[model samples]
Target: MSGVARQIDRPRRWLVVLVVAVILFAGAVVAPSTGITRMGPFGLFAWASWLHVFGYAFLSLTLVYALLVSPDGPALSAAIVPIIVVAYGTSLELLQLLIPYRSFAVGDIFADGLGTVVVVGVWTYGQAAFAALGFRGS
Candidate 1:
């Protein structure tokens, strides 16, 4: 592919990934809960909490990748991506309040924010570390 085509392609691919993440997030949050209250030896709540954490983490990572691959990507993406992801999570939680089978939970929002922060922090640190080691990428 030509340079221009490659550049456009990269952002498009990340955008597709971001869209898929959003769809999965929506489905998870909006779907009615299964009556099964236990998984293996663990309570369903425990698994759900971890799911919220990891799901938002994955969502935020995709957002960062999408922004970074864009032609006009921001220099402060590490700082911005978490805020965006957390906000999205919060909005989804609020949305759950209206669903008959789903209810909003502040704990879920906290978990989502925690996941976003942890992932972004590690990503930013890793980038800085790589730059310091003279292995920076364009």
Candidate 2:
């Protein structure tokens, strides 16, 4: 690692990731079209769905790391991160009900949850593999 990289702390890195994730989440929630309607005939399987997956997946990972690095972070177990991510997705769907151009779609929530789950699952598997190989970093 470079001296500059060593100078920056782990918590600071997690904070930056968390902030960017929040901004992305806010954008996805507020944007009017989000290119969903433009993907005609794709509907649930649209590029929009893929966008949600990737967006929320990164969001979930950031949130987990953020919580992990916080001073009082240990109060909330990391195991709850997936549930929190899914709940956030559901809340976003509910909020869309109030938006004129967006309707509350359960499918969107599912896509978000699926995305978070896939990412977290892969991360968990990777960590387990590393542990089995006697590698420590996660």
Best by TM-score: 1
Q: Please report how far candidate 1 places residue 26 from its true position, in Å.
A: 3.0
The Cα local distance difference test for each model comes to 0.75, 0.70
Candidate with the greatest lDDT versus the true structure? 1
Give Cα distance to truth, residue 121, candidate 2, Å. Answer: 0.7
Off by more than 4 A, model 1: 35-45, 69-75
TM-score per model over all chains: 0.79, 0.72
In model 1, the worst 10-residue window by lDDT is: 35-44
lDDT of 2: 0.70
Model 1 Cα lDDT, one tens digit per residue, 1-138: 467986788778677766867775676566656742234235446666777788888887877777664445444568898888888888888878888888788988898888889988998888789989998465
Cα shift from native, residue 37, model 2 (Å):
3.3
